[model samples]
Target chain A: MFIQQLINGLTLGSIYALIALGYTMVYGVLLMINFAHSEIFMIGAYIGLWALTAIPAFASFTITGFIITFLVVLLFSGLLAVSVEKLAYKPLRQAPRLSPLISAIGVSIVLQNLIMLFVSNQSMPLPEFKTTRYQIFSAEVDTLQIFIFCFSIALMLLLNLFISKTKFGKAMRATAHSHSVSQLMGINSSSMIAMVFFIGGALGGIAGMLNGMYYGSIKYNMGFFPGIKAFTAAVLGGIGNVKGAMLGGFLLGLIETFSAGYISSQNKDVITFCVLILMLVFKPTGILGENVTEKV
Target chain B: MYKLISVLFLGLILIAGCAKQDKNVIKVALAGPLTGDIAAMGQGMKKAIEIAVEEANQSGVLKDKKFQAVIFDDRADPKEAVSVANQIVSDPQIYGIVGHLNSGCSIPASQIYAKYNLVIITPASTNPKLTQQGLKNVFRVCTTDDVQGSAAANYVIDKLKIKNVSIIHDKTPYGQGIAENFKATFENRKDKVLSYDGINTGDKDFKALLTKIKTFKPQLIYFGGVYSEYGLLSKQAKELGLNAVFFSDDGSSSPEYIKIAGSASEGNYVSMIGIPPAKLKKAKAFLDTFASKYPGTDLQPYDTYTYETSKILIDAIVKTNMDKSKIADYLATVKFDGILGITSFDANGDTLNKSISIYKAKNGKFEYCE
Candidate 1:
């Protein structure tokens, strides 16, 4: 029973970590929380649902079909974020902090309602994917869970490497550190910001598709809960730090799962937020967050 | 620019004045969730009420007064329902109301209706507390959840002979009330209730909850929620290899449940209030009219009930001469023979013609089982 709950926790944690990375990355660069990030995730799931169902060749689950879905969702969701940044966030970059926050919220509402109005107001069922279970000792784990866990880890690793080893990543890090200094050093700060939004949006989009595939259903407002949870994870791990976001997400997921399994499912949400509050009260800088000074 | 603006404002005022002066029109308000997850059910109710109003107006139930339906979308939220109730009460033209598909909405909304002497006949809301509020103006066409829960328990214990049962409720007044009743009756019969848990209304993930249920190895898993959640619960339970017989209340009896659950819904049982619309012999005319009017829309489980409730309210209004308080008084002793057979309210304003029919899901359709 413990092992099965752990597996469930880990599967949920992976998706959270994926979405948390988007939150962390955007915060890292823009110093702004993209509240609409969740809607972008939702759009990805809808697009993925559309591709899997509308396209006859990809009607059923296949490796190639999923790969195509991943690419399409990744591209569209990333583009959506880029455009949102350009239209809403970019203009507000020079404005007060609250302005961008309100703008982000407005964008979120618009996106949610647009999907609800145009796409579907009903809960849409994802195309069935055959999952094979393997029994390990007394616990059972399915292929889908394993796939979600592995894919998430691989993406996280790739992101870590990209941030550490790549030149664009180095430029992004420098820009996040000191925007004016990086600009003086001849880096295109706006392009770097756009790139950050794209990568984060892409990751969030993929997470959304994975979430839909895992749950077997999607709704317009489906992103709200997971989005809030992922944001909490991002804050718990240190909002501006990538590694912290990943760690915080897994910890939150495991905590939520174990509590639901052993304690009570009804109170699990209460426990999750309680933990977040305790973390904030004691360690506001977060587990991986450094005491960095804010530039005014 | 000022001249044009004043002209537009005057035109709006004129239209409003004309609408208010229409004395022969008696508006019957219909309030329910017209836009959310349970919209299909609400839309069916609206269509049924519309048909009732059309027929009532054409037949000249009142020689000079004509019936008009004022629709309000409460979105199944309790707060929204209260606001809708307030809106209905403020309007003097609205003589009575047929509404509130959810018990959570209806219970709170019914209070405001009673305060203003506005009569309301809920087509669906099954929570017993709704009628138990002792509100003179509140009534329901269908049975309450206490009856529904006991009937479900009896069916499971005597007919299916189920022993180890697990119950999951959506934590709303409707879901939790019915679940508690079921647990009470089932325990009275000495059946072990493995677990009784609550889940939020809009939550999609239940694997963590289901995984916990798997350890108990319950023989029957009964969910007291709407199709949206129940469908996911059944589908996820199947995926987790939990070999328990799935059962739910009327919320899961809709075709949407099968569509969402896919093949996982097969052989699952759902307890429905009254008879299924297609099999309702008394409602043949109502069904025929509904078919011609809505065209391509399926008849929801409560559509016939809404039709009956609407007809009852209309009859009461006509007899009372469009007096709101008189209509409320008239409805208490009123007995109308119509669809669902002899529609009449008890002392508490609950319908006397009440029965729960069971159905099994097969081939993506709910087939009547008993």
Candidate 2:
């Protein structure tokens, strides 16, 4: 039972981590929270659900087909994120810091409503994954769970490598440190911001697809709560810290699953938020966050 | 001389307005969750109400008096329901209210309706306490949960012969109240309950609770919640290999449930409070009339209930003038043999007909079961 619960937590944590990566990356580069990021995630899920209809044979539950559809959704979502950044956030970039944040909120409302107008609130059912479950000492783990965990971990590792090893990565780091100085060094900060958004949006897209597959249902507002939870995870790990976001996501997932399993599912949310509050009070910098002064 | 002429003109205008009162316009308010989570139910009911009003107008049921529906979205919230009730109360044109679908909203809004002496006939609110409160103006066309729950329990015991059952509720008045009734009925019937738990509305994940429930090894799982969660639960339960038959109330007997649950919804029993349109001999023609009028609207069960409720109110007004006490008296005694078949109010303003219709999801739709 404990092992099963752990697996459940891991599956949920992986998705949270995937989404939290988006929040952490966007914040790291732009120093602004993309409140509409969740809507982008929801749109990705909606597109993926539509794409499933085009591939009727895949509706019988083929793993390869699902992966292909996921890639397409990822690319679509990345492009959507870039366009949104250009339209809404870019104009507010030179304005006050609070201006972009407020703009992000407005973008969120617009995106959510637009999607709600297009898509029904009722969930759309997905194909079944009748993949075999391997039982280990009275605990069972299914193929989909394994895929979600491994796929997210692989993506996170790739993201980490890209950030550390690439020349563009150095340019991104340069901009994050000092935006005007990085521009003086002949790096277009705007393009770097767009690239970061693309990567983050792709991760969120994958998370949304995986979530839709796991739940066998997708709704317009499905991404909102997960988006909020992932944001909490990002803050808990240390906002603007990628590794911290990953850690926080897993920690949040584990806490939620364990609490729901042992204590009460009804109070698990309360517990998750309480832990976050305590973490903020005790270690405001997050687990992997460096000691940095808050900017006025 | 000019001032005297103006005074005479004003007096003539007043007399003309009194004569114009011949064309009576009675506003009937239908308040529910029109645009929120339960908007499907609300929108469906609205369409049904519209169909009823359209037919009434076309047939000239009240040749001189016109029935106009004033719709409001209560969003299934009690506070919003009170506000809707207050709005309806202020409107002198509003003669009666057709709904506040959810018990959470209706139970609170019933007070305002009673206070304002506005006759309310709920098509869906089934909490027993709503009608039992001695509210004169409060009435319903649907059977209460107390009776529906017992019928469900009997079906489970006699028909399915399920010995051990576990109960789950969404913790709202409609869900919790029905689950409590089911529990009481189970006790009365001497059936065994392995475990009972509550889940919140809009909950997606049920693995934690289901896993906990699996330990009990219940033969049947009774979920007193709406269809949104019901579909997800069906799918999740299948994934977890729980293998227990899912039992639910009328809330789950929607096409949306089958749409979301897919194959998992197969064999699950959903208990509706009244007979379905196909089975109801008189309602079949009414349903056909509605469907032909509104091809876009899927004929959900609530449509029939709402249609019948509207007819009852209209017929009452048609028989008696738009008087609250007169309408209440008419509703209390009148045997309304509408499309729903013999809807009459009991002493406490509850529906006299308390038949439960059980349905099984087969081939992606809820089919009636004996």
Best by lDDT: 1
Give candidate 2's TM-score. Answer: 0.91
- DockQ per candidate: 0.67, 0.40
- lDDT of candidate 2 over B1-370, digit per residue (tens): 9999999999999999885454477777889888666678888899888878888888987767777877999987888999988888987777789998998889889898888778999999998889888888889889989888888888999999998899988888888888888888987888898877887677677787777777788999998989988888887787777889999998778888887788899999899988878888888777788778878767775888998999899888878766766888888899988877787888999888778889998888788996
For residues B145-177, write the lDDT of model 1, one tens digit per residue.
889899999999888888889999998888988
TM-score of chain A of 1: 0.97
lDDT values, one for every candidate: 0.89, 0.84
Please state the Cα-based DockQ of model 2 relative to the true two-chain complex. Answer: 0.40
For candidate 2, what's the RMSD? 5.7
Residue range with the least summed lDDT across 10 consecutive positions in model 1 chain A = A287-296
Give the clashing residue pairs of candidate 1, or none.
none
Can you tell me which runs of candidate 1 are displaced by over 4 Å?
A: A291-296, B1-6, B9-17
